[model samples]
Target: MHIIQFEGSSIIPISILTTIASSLVGWIQVKRYSELSASYILTAHEIGVIKEQASYVSSESDFSSFIRDAETAFSREHTQWIARRVANRKPK
Candidate 1:
């Protein structure tokens, strides 16, 4: 570990830098970026599946079913996102 002293040895530059870096990382986690990322990836995968199904559709019923499934997937993702936000808002 390397440390630089400043202000007549009253301040440690290395410790201050470390604290700032950790605070930034903590802020990112607190913002739920990881959960948001996972949600997007999963939603994209679900949409890709729906897209593949779309190509095989040959009738109105099949198209309707695909639309329903796609809507359900979107709603599920949205609900999860809302749940995450609500969870963050609750007293902890």
Candidate 2:
């Protein structure tokens, strides 16, 4: 007669748990980076639009308005990036 009992064998379970945790962390980092990149692209596009509009504006006030709008958009994008970075920070 032979009997086999599974005991004190946690390697497989631990390895799987580690893999899942790592994957989740990696996914979060990738998402955060993607969001940051998108924000940058949006800011760049806004700047381009502002430049185009400025070229056609015939008055100083109109040019100033476009510059103000571009600045606001940039500020908003920076804030969003900061928030995402804070949210994605690793727990201690």
Candidate 3:
């Protein structure tokens, strides 16, 4: 709607172009930041859960198993976070 407001081939002022450019830049930055923030929150919660699970171990064998499982989980989470970070970068 706003773009179509400039229907005719008239000479549009520079201020409108600047305003549109600024708005688009702000929107893109905010979207990327919010996505990164959400992924961080999710990863933090997952790591917290792993820590709580580790706290419940009672025997040596169980503790060893817990450590192995937690290590794998932590690694998986880290990999996924990295993937998300890489995927979030836009070409434009």
lDDT (Cα atoms) of all candidates against the true structure? 0.87, 0.79, 0.81
By TM-score rank, best first, the candidates go: 3, 2, 1
- Model 2, span 10-91: residue lDDT tens: 3355556677899999998898678778878888898888778777787888878887887898889878878877876999
Which segments of candidate 3 are over 4 A away from where they belong?
A: 1-8, 84-92
What TM-score against the true fold does each predicted structure earn?
Answer: 0.62, 0.65, 0.67
Best by TM-score: 3
Candidate 3 lDDT over 1-92, as tens digits, reads: 23323556776677788899999999999997897798778778877888898778999998998889778878877897789768877987
Better of 1 and 3 by TM-score: 3
Full-model lDDT, candidate 1: 0.87
**Where in model 2 is the C-alpha error above 4 Å?**
1-11, 85-92
Q: What TM-score does structure 1 among the candidates reach?
A: 0.62
**Which one wins by TM-score: 1 or 2?**
2
Arrange candidates, best lDDT first.
Answer: 1, 3, 2
lDDT value, candidate 3, whole model: 0.81
